[model samples]
Target: MRAWLFSGLLVLLVGCATPAPDSLYQQLGGQTGITRIVEDMLLRAAADARIKQHFVEVDIVRVRDKLVEQLCELSGGPCIYSGDSMEESHTGLHISRSDFNALVELLQAAMDQQGVSVRAQNQLLAHLAPMRGEIIER
Candidate 1:
């Protein structure tokens, strides 16, 4: 009887054990992966006529770094975003809704190129979607 009870308890404990879920950071391949995504997005943006002008005089390297930081933090990674608020940074740029949408498309393409899963890409985009109001038409 004692042995049977011990076996049953062990089985119950094992059944209750579950692996932790992956954080968004892990789904995004962590820091190195996010860096690659940001770099790819920036390169594409620079060539896109509809939005390239916005980046003409900007510091590309700094923009890449800040984007990486922001993405990392938003995705539950270890980096913190040290850049200005979206509104503050875009205030003078007079961005339009189409411009914002184009940039989002660029980012989605970048993520696709990086082989990110569709669910992960959508999750990241959903997190960023709220910022559109802060970025367009200052």
Candidate 2:
């Protein structure tokens, strides 16, 4: 009986292992939802005087489109990114780690405002976290 019970428990555990969504964007309600979050995040980031200097030289509206496109593609959405490479686009402007972190914070806040669950937000962030290596100044 004990052996049978153990076998049953193992079977149950194995069957419960459903995979997470391959694309976080889909899990977060897709393009419309993602677009809303990105818009909110950019607005908040722009309002931040400490970090707005990064955008002083950029066309914020154009950058906004690129950012939305990039994030959508990275999250496994159907959109393709047509922007310059991170290294190329960010070159010559000595961007600091603090700047990146501030942007991340604003993104998280925007997600919160949009009613995304913490787990979904973290999962999306995890997908983006690796870009820090490429985005930060050496």
Candidate 3:
């Protein structure tokens, strides 16, 4: 009876143990996956009438590099962002809520295209959502 009780308790303890946390970077398929998502997003954004104007004056390659860095760092990958602060970058744009929503939809669609899990997409979105105040000028 004592041995059986000990065995049961051991099983219970093991079952109740917390699992290790999964990294968002790994969930996003590491750097390669991140790059694919960014590329898709940029293409979608460029074609989007609501947001395409914003890309008109910018160097698309530079923009892509910065975005890749930003998303990599945001998702716990090995990259550093070399871009201006969110507020600094958008200070003169006078961006509207609709523009913001348009970009977000494009990002979501890009993530979906890359086969990113809904949970991983939500995780990235939650991390970025706080930047709205800084990015939206109007």
Candidate 4:
């Protein structure tokens, strides 16, 4: 009886063990990983005909900087985003569902290229999903 109790207690303790710390930033390889993902995504977006027109008159460099900053902050990194709010920035753009989907595809491809795990990719996407209302006008 004592042996069975000891085994049960051991199993319980093991079951209660804490999970490893897994912040989105750390899972994404921190600042360097984020920058690489952002750059790759931007390149893809710029090359895609479906969304390239949106950036025709925009400053690509500033956009990249803001993206990196925003992504970093969103992923629980040590960076702070000082850019405009999502709604304010995307206002008047009249972005449609297709446009948003294209950008998300580009981002997913970029994350895959950077070897970001699918779990982390999904985690990031989940966090960004709520911003759709702020970004999409149609």
Give me the candidate number with maximum TM-score: 1
Those runs of model 1 whose alpha carbons end farther than 4 Å from true positions after fitting are 1-21
Q: Write the per-residue lDDT of candidate 2 for residues 83-103, one digit (tens) a residue.
A: 998888887777789998999
At residue 116, give the lDDT of candidate 4: 93
Clashing pairs in 3: none
Measured against the true structure, the TM-scores of the candidates, in listed sequence, are: 0.83, 0.77, 0.82, 0.82
Model 2, residue 71: C-alpha shift (Å) = 1.6
Separately for all candidates shown, the number of backbone clashes (residues 3 or more apart, or on different chains) is 0, 0, 0, 0
17-63 per-residue lDDT for model 3 (tens digits)? 42224778777777788889989999999999999999899889988
For lDDT, candidate 2 versus 3, the one ahead is 3
lDDT of 3 at 116: 90
User: What's the TM for model 2?
Assistant: 0.77
Relative to the unseen true structure, what is the C-alpha lDDT of residue 89 in candidate 2, on a scale of 0 to 100? 84
Error of 2 at 25 (Å): 1.3
Off by over 4 Å in 3: 1-21
TM-score of 1: 0.83
Point out where model 2 deviates above 4 Å: 1-23
Error of 1 at 120 (Å): 0.5
